[model samples]
Target: MKKKDKSHSHSHLAFDHVSFSYKHSDKFTSVFDNINLTIHEKEFVTILGPSGAGKSTFFRLASGLEQPESGHIRLRDKEERHRLGKIGYMPQQDLLLPWRTVLENGLLPLEIKGMNKKEAREKVLHHMKKFGLLGTEDHYPHQLSGGMRQRVSFLRAILGGNEILLLDEPFSALDSMTRYMMQEWLLEQWHEWDKTIIFITHDVEEAIFLSDRVLMLTHPPIKGEIDEVNVPISRPRNEEHRSDAAFMKLKQDLLKKMRSKERSL
Candidate 1:
């Protein structure tokens, strides 16, 4: 469970009437017809949708890997169409280079920016120790467990010092036990760092456990179709919270919403 900052009066990130599309051959596929949403500062928000719901498209848009055909995305208070370097994004797989040791991989972003590699290592070492990855710096990705690899991946994403973190199904590839552990670890990091997080996942329980609010997105060619489900359970959420009466009720509601949304789609 993580403590949430409830003082943010306005959204640190926002999408206003945003519309995006993709082109394949001669066909244009709309991902978002008009998305309007806001995420408050230092809040942990998860976007939940079923399979093939254009979930990845939303992440691509937020990370500036792609752009909307119309409308705008705002960070803090400014419009930034090119959010490329402005966000920290972590894809599902660790994506660590097999040849690089964990330490080398952690230093990559700073190295690319012409930053002093030595300084970057020092900073990362401190965080590694804090993240329980202190002794693994010399290890290659293949040598570490799935959980460890994901931890290293998360460390890489955070090393860039972005205010917001965009995690795309970061724990999906892990075993159930590892996913649970990673979820707990992620909350610890979120609370400690106080960074705003936008996480995407299809798991109802995971969304309930990790987010301040879960945004329900409709099927692709999304057209102003979204729902915000509030997580009323108090922070920091815990194992006890999972089976509690209120939590179960919330989970059931989310399940219903998903099924209904699926039917509609």
Candidate 2:
């Protein structure tokens, strides 16, 4: 008998030949066919594609918000298998409650999980300080700048002690300068937490800047899988790197892939 390989035996998370089509529809259009992918522990993977490439759908599947029509999603977290609460999702909008103070908002998930108020407050405040929202704990969402609100949302996403983060265009709403600063801040925070992150973005530059591996999708509902592009850029990336030849080359290559894929359709 042959010995089994652990990597081949199972994955941290896997979409095995997964296919999804909307329910209760005559068209029964297929989003993807035989889609297979996996994310290992603490790997930073960015899903990049044009609108409607099933990028959002992928996140939904990974986070257990939606199930596959066919095939299976095997998340190897035996402790909390297929549990939605195990994943942290930050949607496109900050979605902060206007009435709740920033601290309360960050502590909501912890409270729901039955953590004591004092413990939740301590954890939320620790993240707030780590992620640069320390002084805004009492402020309402409307009182903060766009960047600050995003920081709060990020804190909330991680507060529940979720190991995997599903980021759906979290920084798309910011101005250019603010977006860049937030990106840097996010990179620093990810370092401190060491969580698995699957970030969805149509912006190739943003994807490349933050991701260790960028997964490019093809068009249509569920038509294509990711074209994994490794970003060789060093950590603590800055404004200066955007002008570097290597960065530009990777950017241009991503554009080319996008254009070629688009033209194919």
Candidate 2: which stretches are off by over 4 Å?
A: 1-10, 24-29, 77-81, 129-148
RMSD of 1: 2.4
- Predicted structure 1: lDDT: 0.85
- TM-score per candidate: 0.89, 0.84
RMSD of each: 2.4, 5.1
**Cα error, candidate 1, residue 114 (Å):** 5.2
lDDT per residue (tens digit) for residues 1-265 in model 2: 1221224433467777788776665667667777878787666789998777878878777788778877778777343336587789987678899999999999899989999889888888887887778888899999998778877887788776788899888887778887888788777767777777899888989998888789878764544354678888876577788888999999999999889978977
- Clash pairs, candidate 2, are 31-222, 32-222
Q: Please write out the lDDT profile of model 1 over residues 70-118, one tens digit for every residue.
A: 8889988799978979899987766798999999998887787778878
**In candidate 1, residue 203 scores what lDDT?**
94
Q: Where does candidate 1 have its weakest 10-residue lDDT segment? A: 1-10
